[model samples]
Target: MDKSVSKSSQPSGGNGFPTSSSNGRKLNKKLVYLCSIVMAVLFFLGIAAFVFLFLLHKNPKATNKNIASFRVDSIFVSRFKLSSSKITASWDIRLSVQNPSTASVSYQTFYTWIQYKQERLSNVTNIAPFQVRGNNWTAENGKLVAKSVRADEKVIEDMATEMANGSVNFNIGLYAGFWIGNEEAKRVWRAVEAHCSDLKIGFSSKDNMGKLIGEPIECILTKTW
Candidate 1:
């Protein structure tokens, strides 16, 4: 009886192999937890990237440099009335210009009358200083400048006389894109570099409820005459 030993109770493998049901269950649970952790990490990374991109889009000041083109719309001379005075010569011209961009913008316009024989320009009538608005437009800030071809009366007077005598065919700029090359316009142009800039003509339309309404800055025609 003393020599009897229990062989059935002894371990089957020499190494500590996980043969118990509890050990197997624990291994499966650990494997599942590892997989879940990896999946969560990947999902979090995707969400982070999406949020970053969305914020970039929402930035107001950030602009797309590669915007293919700036456009002008609904442009018309609208009306023209010539006025004569002993004091000075001035033309009352009304023009409507529009900026077609969804983003806010600023721009300028520049032009001069042609010195025709009978319509010989002794000087630029109704001369006005350059102005800009709507999108922070300014003439002083542009690296490239907008210039008038024949704004001075004396220089243009000689050219006008030459035209009247049939010595020169005097053609002056009547309409142009910029009218003049200036700052806000070069970065964002509705037309040429030399266009009139400093004029305030805009409109805001609202609904009947006194709520916010559509506000489109249209070029207002002042009494040019």
Candidate 2:
């Protein structure tokens, strides 16, 4: 009798393709992960861009507009009642101003050797730049303060100590107003006005150097308690 033959079944290997489908599936999974990572990055970038654009559109200050303004909120002249202190006028003043535009505004503020009742006082120099706009204090409309006299015993101080303590005994008015422009003549006027001996006089801005007022503007100065 002839011997019977048997064969075992097994995967083919000579073509180098029996495990290719599994390898291809692994590759697809890696690609999916890579795509997911790329999508995440793009999503974050898109969100950041959207936020930036939203702020730019919703806020005018963030937009393009560069015209600032300022004001003399309050003024305090110490010793008005007692008139003590032979500098018969050692004083501290308070002024509030604003920047209503987009860019920063700058100007020099010189102490006007006040020639009031025939007395030569000390001169003060203030070459400081005021920048409280869209970058800071935007909600309050770019408002800032100068607490020290341009030419006083103190360069600048958070004044009104007497007023805060109900100890001030003087009465006087310190009025002020000005405008900054994008012109040479206006720049000249900034210097001229800063050196003028009349900031304590009146707020008649209509009679200034020119009929043009640009960057900064203030309301009529008034005396207040």
List the global CA lDDT of all models.
Answer: 0.35, 0.35
Model 1 misplaced stretches (Cα beyond 4 Å): 1-5, 12-16, 20-27, 60-68, 72-103, 107-225
The alpha-carbon deviation from the true structure for residue 158 of candidate 2, after best TM-score superposition, in angstroms, is 49
The 10-residue segment with the lowest total lDDT in model 2: 208-217
C-alpha RMSD by candidate, in order: 16.5, 16.4
Predict model 1's lDDT versus the native.
0.35
Give lDDT tens digits, candidate 1, residues 130-178. 4433333332211111122234445556433443442333222233332
Error (Å) of candidate 2 at residue 101 is: 6.2
TM-scores of all predicted structures: 0.30, 0.27
Candidate 2 has an lDDT of 0.35
lDDT tens per residue, model 2, 1-225:
233222123334434456777778999999999999999999999999999988875543443332333343333333221112223333333334445534334433422223232333333323243434333332111111222213232311111233233332222222222234344463212222212122331212232111112222243322211
Which stretches of model 2 miss by more than 4 angstroms?
A: 1-9, 14-18, 60-225
**Model 1: per-residue Cα lDDT at residue 12:** 57
- How well does candidate 2 match the true structure in TM-score terms? 0.27
